[model samples]
Target: MTSVTSLPASEQEGARTSPEDPEKLEDPEKATLSTDPSETSLPNNKRVEQPTKINWLLTCVGLYLGALLYGLDTTVAATVQASVYEELGNLQKLPWVGIGFPLGSVAVILLIGKLYDTFEIKWLIIGSVTLFEAGSALCGAAPTSNALIVGRVIAGMGGAGMYIGALNYISIFTTSMQRPIYNALIGLCWGTGAILGPVVGGAFSDSSAKWRWAFYINLPLAAVVSPLYFLNFPRYNPQPEHTALEKFKQIDWLGAFLNASTFVLFILILSFQGPIWRWAAPGSIVLWVLFGLSLISYGLQQTFSILTSPERRLFPIDFLARRTLLLMFFATSSAAAATSVTLYYVPLFFQFTKGDNALEACVRLLPFIVPFVFFVMFSGGLLPVVERYAPWYFPAGVLMIVGGALMYKVSPNTYTAAIYGFEILIAIGTGLVFQTGYAVVAAKVPAHRVAASIGFINIAQIGSICITLAIAGSIFGNLGFVKLEHVLTGYGFTDSELRSALAGSFSPVFQHGDARARKLAIEAVVSTMGTSFALVFVAGAVTLVSAFCMRWEKLGLQTTAGG
Candidate 1:
């Protein structure tokens, strides 16, 4: 260097630096500096860091809060439906209030989950939350039943996106070590929502507040969370090398369409079967046919996607093939069906049989909700101690079966303690199985597809609920008040008197009657409702059978230290 030897082409330009330059190459500090622009322009790995631990914690808290809102929205409408129906003066349309939210939410869950996979989730969350608040506001202001239904439908869209997005985000953000806690948090949110829905609805309805306040309450919560979410949540910018169009092309839109159609048609058909259309009606038959065709189309599309894709499709056939996932689906579906059946009939029983008002009816249901919350928390703790889920699964099935059988035994004169005990059995069964099923599915499926799997499981669950509710409603309708009145005519009660008494509810048939007449009428109602419980028992038995089909080892039979 001192001899001034010729430099390479690249270095020659730098060596001939002008005197105007800040420093000469002979300077030690200057010599150490990188003259190459590329070297100096390179990104600093240490300087450009990822989100801090505090940011992650905040994100999780936000997601958990979002999940709570999602679950609460699903059932809160149910508690206020009676009031809504009474105000609207259409008891026939009452079921729609409960059905609309779940149907709409279930319809979009898988699609939304897949969208999250293909696109940025943060925007979807923002849009969903905004939609939720708007819907809530609209519902609060609605003057007609149709307007309220529209609001509910809009809210359901938001709920579907929020729920699926939360699950997807949690799955991606949490490590295996954190999954147990993360999943437990989700379970807690759902459980809490289920518990609070009745209480909130009852309180609002019982007070001077209109039933509309139930929908309105969501707005303030949404406003508070939205800004915090926008500020603190990390922006997920996809690498620019891949354009948005290319990403969009990768989504299976056809699959989405078919899946939505299938659910819509299926739910519509199920809804029509009870009072809208007789079981054997031609319109019902056509709906069933349409539902079948849609299902077939959905399956074919999925199959084609799997066969034709260059990369593995989002829904791999192998995931569905997993025995653990299948069993978990059945377990969840049956448990959900049981819960739906209980919720549908219990209030009616309290109102009619027990002569309880709306608030009192809801309070009477505490036996189910209280035990459910307790068992859910208790099971989260016990999961770490138990090595296998099979033990829990078996007991859960037994409890459900026993509960259904005992509930079938309830009569006009049945002791309050017995009724509470039966409710406890149902609650324990539901709580034990629900979280365990999710755990099993998560264990069997790839981590990335957990949201999709959950969506599918929830679809099955909602499907079961819809079908069971329809069947129960059909049974109730078929056993008309007129028929019941005629049956009670020979009990020293005139036809006019019987009609007036039975007009309000099926309860007077059970209570405030001659001993022999009460016994017969109660027997008749029980025998009729027994058919519904029999279906529940059958569902429980199927769950038990499916439990044995799950591969224990594959389902993480070796429990984690903190599961």
Candidate 2:
């Protein structure tokens, strides 16, 4: 290994050896050196750091279980939304329950990632878990819609922190090759919690237990796992000592605030459009303008301000400016957009078009859900073995496109086997792409910038999910209602019946009198959903196109200093 004194400042900060110099790099473990500033900067300050031997199995169990906490809230909350609405009698406040956590999470994610980069990770992990537990307690005990929403937001911050913290944690302990395995496990756990969330919520909702138990469930698990965090987690020496005021100046507070505000407002605009106001309504227009201004201001801040100057930009513009990263962003966004939209609508296809009950549709979705987790784990396992990640990128794109195309052909009477095959295809495709961003980013970025890089990737995924859901909702709202109204009127259903049907769930249309009218309404739903799924195909196509620009890179086991 090269001495710190021998390298240039750029190298010290996070420069890597040229690919031509691969033979000169350290063993993979040595290559992933702790980027603690105190270790590198103080030449004579003899800090004899040594690697901590971890029980990887115990570590994996603790980490994946912690990962599940983030997903449980969303899934469980979604399941109990109806009961919540019934009990609270304020349906308008319901969306806030969803909005609050992500908003709080977005606010802190960018900064928190950087914090983990330079601080004691153990405390951060423990604190985040404690925060999550605290929020869960509040939600379980909340007496009003507003109270629950507030608790959700607090917990969301903790979750966002946990997610990034998990990434940082793996990077700290596991070699580059081992990271995908842990990432896969974490992704699968999160995915499992999500798939099971509604079911668990339903169980509690139906049982003598209150829906609040859904939130409360997190308590014991968190309590049990926190001890492992302290015992097994490695420690890093803090960066060169600085006074409180000096260290405070180092953070990009302005940039973080601006970016957080912009995302929150963006979510607000989407949340308001349907539940509260029309797009053309004054409230919508006002929020739209606010969102636009906030975004523009954030961009300017990143470009100009000292707090968010080019050197310390909250988003790390130079890193993201690379063609490879941009394409990755596009690929992830398109894939997430595709998967999220499909996940949102596929169950509807079974429920509305085929008239399966909600529970039955959920059960039918198990094929897709099960394969998704399997492939996510499978792909994670595979990445470590593959010589080049780029080769796998193409197949991921191909499978997503193929799966999405098949999904587009779905109808009320489509073969059960066909849908199952299509879902499995998509699931496998998703698993391939899901971890690509994290692994590739880790491979490319310097240790100092790793957390920031992961956070950026996280933001892209979240942004796509939010935007895709909103667009999908709009399309479903516009197309479903229009088609049903036209079909119902054609079948001699009165305008009043059409109005009532349009205002609520389409299930009633099937329940109403007149068999012919029901048939038309069912057809209308199928047609509308087909159009929606077609957009998912579009998402797949976008991913395929973007994959071309994502450069092929080999995952070398040899590590480089602070790489």
Local distance difference test scores for all models: 0.63, 0.65
Models 1 onward score TM values of 0.80, 0.82
* Number of clashes recorded per candidate: 0, 0
Please, what are the lDDT tens digits per residue for candidate 2 over residues 444-511?
65454556668777776656655665566556555666787776665656544443342224334555
Candidate 1 residue-wise lDDT, 140-239, digit = tens: 8988887887787788778777777776665544433345456667777776775566557766766799688888998888777776577665444322
Q: Highest TM-score, which number?
A: 2
> Candidate 2 — which residues are off by over 4 angstroms?
1-57, 92-100, 237-240, 243-245, 353-360, 478-527, 558-563
Please give the RMSD of candidate 2 to the true structure. Answer: 6.1
**Highest lDDT scorer:** 2
For candidate 2, the TM-score is 0.82
Candidate 2 colliding pairs: none
